[model samples]
Target: MSDLKTEADSLNRAGIKLSYAADPLNHPLADFKSASHDLSAFGVLGSLLKATGEVREGMTELADVVTALHDEWQAEGKAMLDVGKVLDQVDRLLQESLARKHG
Candidate 1:
């Protein structure tokens, strides 16, 4: 698979573990809305990595996801910035991680 897809897979797996550890049953947002929602295979892996502290290693994965999603939006020559709400979630997750890490 492409690097983005690989990273996405990793993030989905890790995110699930993190959610479970954080008490998904109580935290409504972090937990995927659907039981079959395979978050580890999620497209916004980079943001999820940052949100889950995986960014400390490096930002390659996050950048890849962002770029791929960005490309997807522009593939049809639409030049759009947002696609499938991935960018929105990535922004929020990254900001939250920054606050928790440095602030």
Candidate 2:
């Protein structure tokens, strides 16, 4: 259905935005390395080491959210397929019933 397609497209765009937000968290180790470099150069890591554990936990939580969203999207697609199959079967059955009555 066009409405479903539209909603799917909107959800896809939202997912993309969420993905971008999560990308920075994906490379925390690399960022930590950079912060270490900064600390050596400027004697300040900007609370980087102090927040490492919290940052890791937050990243994990965000990743879990994204995974959950993906799983829901997959289930929705399957549901749509099932609906279409049911509709097709109903159409076929209706046609058969009509023919039997007329004959």
Candidate 3:
């Protein structure tokens, strides 16, 4: 139905936007990792550096999860679109067959 198609379109668009948003996180994550490494060279901030490392690890994990979710949503959207197309075709065929029988 049109509702299914609409939902599929919405998911696809949202996935695209999510991809764009996740992309910016990569740059910042890289920068944070680099900064964390740079902070490690200083001896006085040992405890702070450890905390930074942990935070960086957590950020990396979060980014990975977000990227994975984006991929899943995109795949789901494509699958939904495919299902909608198949259903539409079947409906059309049924309608045609009925018309032929009635005519």
Highest-scoring model, TM-score:
3
Q: Lowest lDDT 10-mer window, candidate 1?
A: 76-85
Best by lDDT: 3
For residues 3-86, what per-residue lDDT tens digits would candidate 1 score against the true structure?
434455555555444434423233443232332244354346665654444432334454445445545533432212223235
Q: Can you list the residue pairs that collide in candidate 3?
A: none
Q: What is the lDDT of residue 24 in candidate 2?
A: 50
- Per-residue lDDT of 25-46 in model 2, one digit per residue for the tens? 5476445544543434322576
* TM-score per model over all chains: 0.23, 0.53, 0.60
Tell me the whole-model lDDT of each prediction, alpha carbons only. 0.44, 0.56, 0.62
Cα deviation in Å at residue 14, candidate 2? 17
How many collisions per candidate?
3, 0, 0
Ranking by TM-score: 3, 2, 1
The parts of candidate 1 lying over 4 Å away from their true place are 22-103
